[model samples]
Target: MVWAGMCAAIDHLRTHKNGKLIIFEKGGGFGGTWRDNVFPGCCCDVYSNLYSFSFEQNPDWTHIYPNQEELLAYLTAVAQKYDLYKYVRFNTAVDEARWNENKKQWDVTVVVNGGKDSEYGSGYTVTSDFLISCVGQLNIPKYPHIAGSDSFEGKIMHSARWDWSYPLDGKNIAVVGTGATAAQIVPEVAKVADHLTVLQRAPAWVIPRHDSIISEWRKSLLRHVQPARQWFRAESMKARESFHEAVTQAESAKAKQMREITLAHMHKQLPDRPDLWKIFTPSYSPGCKRSVLSDDYYPTFLRDNVTLETRTISRITKKGILFQGQESETEFDLIVLATGFETFDYMHPLKVFGRNGRSLTEIWHGLPRAYKGVTIEDVPNFGMLFGPNTNLTHNSLILVIEAQSRYINALVDAVLDVKAHGKHLSLIPKLEVIESYNLDLQKTLKKTSFADPNCNSWWKNSEGIITNNWSGTAVDYQNLVSDVIWEDYEIEETDGSETFVLRRKASTHIGRVNEETHLSTSTLRSAFVKCRSFLNWFCYSWNSQVDTQYEQVLKLSSDSEYNKPSRRLET
Candidate 1:
């Protein structure tokens, strides 16, 4: 599912130019995550107002946090408004995108017509001069490697691929993982299921979210009073701005205060279950992992049928999961794996080949970095929307995506300008610029508590290097790329001629003629009179009013004395 970021980029490019945009939607249609993730109680972690594109806001959002179906419908509406469906080739999955340096275009390999009618037919190649990859970071699911996990005969489901046909009522269900996905699923399932066992690996820094229904009157005010929406969005953005510091401050006063608040919340929810409250206290600092937001997740442990298990798994059988130290093995009718997506894995499942056939993924080696999180110096004419170092803790993804889109649009125009001037352009960012930028980024992050040695989170790679999040705020990114640093780029002329020509020799117009030599005296006046009458008649007809100007011209033209030019319109 392609989200608003890619949609806005395509719309901008298409509106500015008349070129056809061929969207390779791997899924059946648009909606990206909203269409694919339909688990019970699925809702956006981000507020609904800021989640949408800036240009196309959905005032009719049902709640502060919209559910999956509402967000999906909003995406579908944006697609229809821009007539984006005509350009989309649905059910076409891209295998590899190769940059053709010789042809100066991208050669894409895709599997088209994968629905029932065509039966997932053969592969074909399509090419484009420029490529924008919006294949987002959160699609692939990660399964746990428990011994005999697959040997179970009962129904198994991933959170991303929920099995809706299986009912939870009167069923003993086992839920795996306690990240963001499991937090939402546990509360909803415990309310209906006969019994629920939540298997958790580590505790998350869970916080309370003030998410409530956006009343009809408020939605009405926001719809009609446009500033109300803008004001609300501004307030929401300002509220989240300081959270990044709170999470990154380690055991500092701010971090300690946040930890205290969270502990208090947990205690309030689990007043009788001090053991459950202790289970939630994390060994690492806050913001080590992306924090979860929900009101009912902690209170779920109070339910009589809910069980929170934090033991290490020994193995799995058809009956259920076996604990490491305990001999009693639990059995369940169904198992739901809320194992999260590969968030740190950028552009997974799609291999990209850039300049000289070098694999872009091979260069990163599971740790991706880019200049401004969009441009890789080695890769020319290729860009990404939500690339590495772009995930946010205290800002909107849509805001960052728009900033990247606007900046990348400038790069796209720069490439087009080079071609329009009869030159082949090859842009490779200078090596020092990228090095200096990343160095400063790492330096900034190291001082934060998130960079503490004890903190092990998805924000970092296997080598203990922070790879997923931005070192600064989203506003900092917006200010950094507000203008394209053309000087930092190595723009070479591929034809071996020269760099861009700045100044040319002076020149002047040579062809000239006197108006009197080519035209007669009566001819000019007669033409002016005829033009005046025609314009007058046209203006009146266009305004849906009648005029006698053309009739007067006809009467004057027929007169014997009217062969001479009329003097009235001479000026």
Candidate 2:
């Protein structure tokens, strides 16, 4: 677990009887994207009420869409509230995780930077029964393919890695790429910059959002009344689901109306600058590219000091940026490449070795496909969050992540049962299962806006396969991951000796255990509400063996080693 996605995975695992969670964050602190992306006016597109862990919802958001600082503070508070910092090893980056067939464990390598001492300066290895890749799709930032990015004499920076020390109060700035990050940065920079030039390769549809502050009374209602908070959250989720047409059906009447709504705003804002309107209007479908929501992004273009460049970029010179086939160049004191992340790379910057010494990157060959976008065929005992085709265009990604973590924990519990049986086990999804699933997935995604060929986005891979997002609504993904179909996996059992128990379900001598250690079925079921039926949700009759076994599992989690919180950094 490296970033926000992994932080969530860590949170889920800690609650279960799963093994110890050692979080290796490459940064000095947690919060992932919220911690790293500190560009001017950078904020979440989704409403704050819904953009959080379902287990722990915050009712104190000042704005509907919280700013970077507020989002980060919220995440930090979440980590503190959960006591997650103690288990975290900050400044430690995980390099590779290889599955050991003999030990049936994952051998992980990590390089530690800025640790307490030189003991871990050269890095070390750790082994665990399960491996989860929570390194999200947006971890690595993508830079523009300019000829002289490194050679540029001026201050150059990426939106993800904003350089705050460099002053931009009265300097001429060039912001590249008209994406989400650029959309927010351009407005704030133009406020004080002498001249701000926005470089646009493609235009995205801009929707109006009433991103106003939440009043004290409303915040109090959300905080004091539980039903009110739930109602608000439910309505916000429903609003996201209402975008089904704009995201999936471009030719539909609703999609057209949605398009007109954005154009109406543009018509009202850019009446005097019709040339700019033509340049800003997108020829592609409304949902082909990610739609931007802002109250001021369009109006900021009307400022006298702000300029929008719609031409192709040729290269970057020592002084400024040069345009294609144009002799003239725009001089700037600083440049911010608001270009997004390398999403098509999928699980890039991390090496994962699965069955038969096959690397995950080599298996996909730069293309990612998964069973339900959570499980893979070759990667035994390994799971990932926000994996291929799991990103959502309509609902908050937090919902998808919640579903995924629940499903993953279900698998982890299954593995834990096998470990308790004094057996080495490995569960990998069947190839036929994933192939069939992906075949239907590709067919379904073809009709969605993510697969639109008119505009380019990181949503699709080089093969034109929509690998970055889920085609269905958030609720659909929730139902799909609600159950863990055991038959879909190929389970291997080795007793650590020459003997092998192949394709065997976890045997606990069901219905037989000492009566003295028995716990009631109702009591066991109530113990773990989140993992309700953790021991056995499949079997109809409650077994005494499972009851005792479940008690042992609970005991493991409640034990001093697991229950005792490590030394955490106080907020």
Candidate 3:
């Protein structure tokens, strides 16, 4: 699934399963990024089977990968099925959020309909017992800082904010940047545009998508047979899991194999054009930056109407783009800036103040850090989804979102349990907990291909610290946040009493997988689990006993005993 839309599912689950959740969506609809990014050929790289929630398996996928429209339809269906619209305030944007110490609530400032003059449309403040931030990283678009960008007389558009009203047929177009978004847009634009020029700073490693249509019979079988769907999802997830080594270790055998596979795919596509091959190949490792999965991106260059330009753009003129060394500029009818988003600006443009009036942005100082990518050290009663160090390069983010939603639900339960006794509560982790945690995390990240010095990427900060991705595999991160250690927090209650202490549950609520399980073992176990689920369905029982097993391992300690926090990084 697209990473931004997962928050809607989390909102649905929380309302039904946990608290009286209220959502503040900045748009008029449900789908987040899927609703915003409607560029040509916009689709997910992950397979359709594994891109959805485990409980909501879609049996109507037409292709192996679903496009933006289909994914948005799925999210809209989910919101309607769960009646989440009643709880959502549409066209509402959160401007600022501050903690009230006495009331133990969040005073949120919101603007309705951009503060227009409509009925009940204006800026106001609302109070809530708890606050959760689901504004994902990819929401804001990033534009290039080229000189004289305002002088362009023709139509200019960012890929994220495409203008559908503009015509593309029989027009001369120029597309800048060769990232994932550009990889998808170039092929579709090339089919209709009279002439297309692809401006690139550096080339990306390309691989075959191997996408195919799912037959009607197969879709029916998957819908009717419980085992068939489970097995399909498991197989797809297992294939994606193997890519962890290829993306993490630069010198590993898996990385070498990935480079060879990418090179072979590129060679087969552009076999006759030896000069273009050198222009397309990258000098860095395959996993140093995000790789492109396509069967059409390379072949688009073979068209007689297309040209690939690798020169640096000096400025934007009234006619077109101007290269650094050239005196003249090439003219175009339209300019498509396929530049990506501002990924590192977490919770930006929204001010947040914590305890003692501490600014969240100032605290981060351009390096956003959080414990387990969920909660900050000084931010009490506030939980953030898709926070720091939670992005993945090799797998779908739905897995991470599932784990984080469960963890946040646990924190909410703890706070509500205290309120049940007519008392107020606030909890924050010790400062040293995240400090030591990130220190060990960065130590492991330096050894991965993401931190390779050959290429720059959105995964790191200006200081070259990897502030976007997790240090280990998706499974490794799932294990780390499987359980919340209550003893690690500085819990406080009202009435000037210290008698409240939350009891640990025997097991967490989410499904569990063993840390040492291998690929072959997981494949075999999935078969048995699917068969069991199929049999239980016939018996009119819907128990996930074989699928959902929670791990419970926690030891309680006093505040003083938990002084020096030291938790070993698993994997």
Task: Find the candidate with the highest TM-score and give its number.
Answer: 3
**lDDT of each residue in 151-242, candidate 1, tens digit only:** 78778889999989889999999999888889999999999999999998888888766566656655665687575466456545544554
Q: How does residue 525 of candidate 1 score in lDDT? A: 34
Predictions in order: lDDT: 0.72, 0.74, 0.77
CA lDDT of 269 in candidate 1? 79
How close is every model to the real structure, measured as TM-score?
Answer: 0.84, 0.85, 0.88
- The stretch of ten residues in a row with the least summed lDDT in candidate 1 is 508-517
Mark the regions of model 2 whose C-alpha exceeds 4 Å error after superposition. 1-19, 115-120, 496-571
Judging by TM-score, tell me the better candidate of 1 and 2: 2
Q: Model 1, which residues run further than 4 Å from truth?
A: 14-17, 116-121, 497-571
> How many steric overlaps does candidate 1 have?
2
TM-score for predicted model 2 compared with the true structure: 0.85
Positional deviation of residue 322's Cα in model 2 after best superposition, in angstroms: 1.6
Pick the winner on lDDT between candidates 1 and 3.
3
Q: Give the local distance difference test score of model 3.
A: 0.77
Instruction: Give the clashing pairs for model 1.
Output: 1-32, 248-449
Better candidate by lDDT, 1 or 2? 2
The full ranking of all candidates by lDDT, starting with the best, is 3, 2, 1
Better of 1 and 3 by TM-score: 3
- Residue range 71-178, candidate 3, lDDT tens digits: 999988877876677778888888999999888878999987843423675778988777778898987889889898899999999999999999999999999989
